[model samples]
Target: MNNTKDFAKSSWIALVLIVLLNSCGSAVKSTPPPLRSQAEVVSVGQDKVEDSVEKKLENVKIGDAQAYYYYQLAVLSLASGNIEEAVDSFYNAIKLDDKSPFLHTELGKALARKGDLSKAKEACEKALGLDPSYLPARTLLAAVYSGLNEKEEAIKEYEKIIELNPREVQPYILLASLYKERKEYDKALGVLNRWIGRHQNSEVGFYHMGQIYLEMKDYEQAARSFEKAIEENGDFIQGYSALGALYENQKQYQKAAETYERALKVLGDDPRVLDRLLRIYTQLKDYNKALAYAEKLKDMSPEDEEIDVDIGVIYYESKQYGEAEKLFRGYLDEHPENIEVRAYLAATLEENQKYDEALKEWEKVLEQDPKSFDTRIRIGMLLSEQGKHDQAIKMFEKTLELFPDRIRSYILLGASYNQAKRYEEGLQVLQKGLAVNEKDPALLATLNFHIGVSLERLGRFEEALTTFKKVVELDDKHSNAHNYIGYMLAEKGIRLDEALVEIQKALELEPDNGAYIDSLGWVYYQKGMIDEAIRELERAVSLIDDDPVIHEHLGDAYTKKGLFQKAVSAYEKSMKLKPENEEQVQKKLEEARVKLKSQITTHTTGR
Candidate 1:
């Protein structure tokens, strides 16, 4: 409903009546108010709000012309969002008509909006004084008391409101909300129970009750209440929303997805529910369902251009970066002001290996939102990926300068320094990060692990081992630290037995980790168990066929077993996989070939 126009038109009757009564000139013709104005085309706009103001407007009657005119202006100003002017008009209307409770209540509302809680309280009190049973005044007074942190007063007002009119559902809901806030769970439930008994199809009470149970950690009761909420009112989207959120919080993703789909069965693919479903599916990595929902949402809400961004994100997550990039670019062409979609485009470009294009987009994003922490991190990481270690280090330093409290920035800057082989700087940076989040074990483990890496690269073996041990102590489940400790022990080859135990423990932590498996194979090889080493290394190779280190380990095992032909094949495969020590691999390949030829000659001669 056009509330401003309707209220303004409603006052026309009083205006004409006053003008005709006190006219100083010839009489003017007056038309009667119609039962249905032209604006009553259909049901009012319930697409957003639940109720229409038409019902409330029926009681609005003004006898004074000047007061009525000021009242009309105030309502019009309120709708136009001119709060100051509306407040002034409301004040003028109240002065001209002090007995009208509606005027006082409206003034109180306007004052509350202006953050003048004291005066608002006074106005609401004045309205209640004029009419003891004025429910609007009581409601406004309750809200004002709540705003002033006078909870007991607010509770009294809501209770009196319910006592005055028990059939009114709003007072019950508001009163229950007050009880819920005070953690009076039983009282809140009792109020809601009364509310449910009094009002038909009032799912809101049950939904609020579900929230209360959820907050109290009563999962069983919460689920039942949510179910009852949805069952009570088929159109209550909040009920389904609460159910979906509850299931997700419990990690019952399948049930959450089912609840989201059930909303469609009742609401027929409401855009709000579909949007939630699209996000939930995306989070679950169910790309097929996510894409399908995105398409349906697009078709349903063609005017919601932001749906294009959602579709692009789905394509991006599914690793169809080409499609994502195309879609994002198309959207940006029409709406270049969309910085968020441009960020998606940058990510897609990075995935597609269009580094230069990605860099440009990141630069544009940084220009638009200079304080975006993640964008700064991404730009630095991209620079590091391109081997521009100095530039990456500088970018990360700037990020640290801007956001000193962000622990991740310190980690990133440290990583860049470590990549540049500046071990001291990397160590110092990690230590700085450790100073703050000293109590967060996960963060400590991360910083200590990176520090350990820097120490290992600096040839500080014993210190690095000690740091890794510290990391394990901080977080025993940290598989990376376990693998590092095991790999380092195996490489030293002094404590072969201890190395074997460590590597086995690492494999126990992450059974499918190819690097840990390779460490195990290396431990076996150092112990002269060539056959065992070969088996483990071959398994590691199968697990991570692209790893050069695993292939090289298999080659070494084959050489130890004197299977020169197989050894030659393994070394050639290692070389093909691009081992870092290419020259060493080439020398090993030559030696393996010579050994194979010698073996072949000896076998033939012996035959």
Candidate 2:
């Protein structure tokens, strides 16, 4: 229902009345003997007193000028928003003129403002009792009912108000809101539509309708409504923002970008608009644009850790790893507790080959939050890559403690155990994983492959061959399985022809994979095709220069071909690459040297 301007004005008066009443309770026992004038009762404005007496009260008969002054003062005070003073002046005015129900309604609103709901209700009822058609009293009654949360009664009062003044807009708005609060969405829309038909030019009406559409997930209608609102009022900031959000939700990134740009024009220096643009640009893969908007947002809120993180991500995604690292460090300095930043920084460092540094960062994250199973797994994987197999196993085991179902951790930990030559532990771990998740293709394949690796390392070639066959049968497309089993078979001298087929299939799947290429080369070497083996091994070494195992394979191929000096050189290079194999390489080197010296001595003696 419509709250008249006077009702709002009267509420302020009610606050003053409460303050004055509380202040006076200990000071004055009764209403002070009637003031000589309303001006004497309170600080009345000069123009107001003069205007009230000269204009509104001149037609009414009062017992004395003080009565006239108080009567006019009450109406003047109510009009002026001095509601408490209005109530007091109204009481005095009634003392002079008691027949006016309109004045009682004013008094009721003041009472309502003071939270005297009971008295306010009585006063409003009395005003209606005195004048059955008193619209102001009825409207005040609705407000009182609303304050008491008597929603049905409030609605009834508002309906009465609408009936009395069919052309008014406020009662329609309130009724619509009431229906919306009750989740009667269709009814709410109906009310709003009817209201919009009458108030078509109201941007507020359009905005409200747009919000309703948004709630219903009617993006098209919502966008249309928001656009209409914007067109009606070009400076409408919320309309533009709402429209932009609608487009974003629809994945119409370009439209969303344009809408946000318009919103930025209307709301200069708004952080929210900048953030929306940043997100949109990221989705569009327009990293440069995303960074620009991110910088703008940072300029406004320099300490916003989320925006800084976004800027870092843009850099990282665009392959500007160095810039990304700097920003990530800057963000970490400010928001050291942010796990996401720590994780991203770790990932970025890992991508840049700073594996040890990344491991340390992930460790810190785990230290802060031991429940971070994902980070623990990443650290374990990094450690394994760096050949810290035992440490990597520990990290993976800790991760398994937190998340027993993460089968990837089992695979990684098992692989690390094999790398450390703890074949028994590796088999047990893969077996445990397989027992739990039999249908998991990746896990099953990995289990079979690792079992084969461990059995072969233990010199159980027959058992290893059986396990490798199981791995290929379970997943023919498992390229590594093909490579390893084929390489193992060729090495064991039991099925050289069959091994060639498996390794060739593996090479077909991943031709450029250096390890797979090396496997093919080693299989050829086992088959005694010295020239072909050398060609394949040389290609593998060229593809991956850092792998000591590949260099060792090259040395073995050369030795098999009777190239003593070349074999020694290849063995020394392998040892230099990985001193962890120094003892084996030195023995091989000494044997090659002795063989070369004996051949030289025999040639000299024969000459």
Candidate 3:
């Protein structure tokens, strides 16, 4: 709803009535009896004045001139912000000329301004009764109802006004705006469509239609309407901006860029448009264009230091790590307290493999906020990556001390211990994590999987199997659990068919996974399907050529199939690839060589 004070201040109808009364020489008599003081006038409120003013007004002779005199006084009172006097004057005018709808409507407007909506609505209804077709009275009534927040009543008044005068464009716009405010998109569209049908050239109507369609999530129709609105008026900056925003929402970066560029042509050097163009170019990874716009934005908004960070990020995303590091370091040198820039600088340093420098920056962040859990985790992970397992474990333990319920701390600490071959310590850490987060399914599954790995490494086969089964039960689609259980069973020489089924399930989930393929091949070998074993092992070797275990498995399969020469070649390759079972593989290689030599000698002598 429009501000009642602004509406009343801009009331053209009141101005016209004042002008008409003045032209007819119907001014209120200056020497009239002192009716009421300003305090008495205000005290009357919206109630009927039973003061001296009403008694004097009742005694006045009834005529058009007399009614105009009272109407002139009301208009002046309304202009002076004396709502009580205005209401009394308008009521006096209505008593003299009860047939004048304009007087009744004016009375309603004054009462509405005085915070008397009920009486105001009653006065508007009386005006409509006096002259049903009076557009001014109907419009005033609509505004009054809208002010009262009686949306349905206001809509009825607006619709009635539109029915009475279909050619008037204002009513349609007002009604559509009202519906739009109420979130009645269909009704708003209905009103706008009617207006557009009558005034096909109205750019504003088309723009409003586009807004309604956009609100309804009908992107196609909204784009069409926005396009049409622009076609009707090429200088429509708002239409171009809206179209750009719609394209951005749809992820059409190139089109959004073009639309925002068009907006720039119409509104040159606009910072908002430039910012949008920069963002779009950044998303498209067109760094050159993005940098250009970012520079322009920086120049336009020189006080916004965040733009410097944006430029540094663009450099980082473009893989120009040296440039990003330089920029962030320079920015930090001037503003050392900027934690965000310092973090970005640390990331840049880490990306450039300057681990020591990155660690220093992260430590500084800890100084600023010692409770920064994620940063501490990053420090731990970096330490772990650099082979400082002891330091990494200490950092993760410290993180757990600060936040005992942090699941990631437990997971990372367990991983560190496992990486250092401390299986018992890893098991303990994971068990602690499980105890804390037992009810959380995802965390439970992860902890159980890790526990199973630790148990397997510690040679607790039965416990490991039970833990793997628990993982599978927790989440049936855990491919790793199935593969681990299958490989473990096959290695133990038990449950061969069950192992094959589990390995096959794992392979089904990840058809192209080299690890799963290797497990399948190993299971096939355990089941005595030598041809199937060789075929699968060859495929696994082809998929993951560098895995030493796959090479060893292929060598074993070859030896089992009586291909002694091929077995020697496979075993030698496994040894070359740094097999963990170096002694065992050497024994296998010597045996294969001896078998080949013996078979050759026997075949030659017998022949």
TM-score of each: 0.75, 0.57, 0.65
lDDT against the true structure, per candidate, is: 0.80, 0.75, 0.81
Q: Model 3, 140: alpha-carbon shift in Å?
A: 8.3
Q: How many clashes (backbone N, Cα, C below 3 Å) per candidate? A: 0, 3, 0
For 287-350, candidate 3 gives per-residue lDDT tens digits of 9999999999899888877788889988988989999998898888889988878888988999
TM match of model 1 to true structure: 0.75
Task: Give the least accurate 10-residue stretch of model 1, judged by summed lDDT.
Answer: 41-50
Which stretches in model 2 have alpha-carbon errors above 4 Å?
A: 1-184, 249-252, 300-310, 330-340, 405-409, 434-607
Looking at model 2, report the run of 10 residues with the lowest lDDT sum: 23-32
Residue pairs in clash, model 2: 13-82, 13-83, 13-84
Candidate 2 TM-score, C-alpha based: 0.57
Give the local distance difference test score of model 2.
Answer: 0.75
Ranking by TM-score: 1, 3, 2
Please provide, for model 2 over 329-400, each residue's C-alpha lDDT reduced to its tens digit, 9 standing for 90 to 100: 998898899888888998999999998888889888888888876777788889888988888888888776
Pairs of residues at least 3 apart in sequence or in different chains that clash in candidate 3: none
lDDT, residue 452, candidate 1? 96
- For residue 416, what is the lDDT in candidate 3? 84
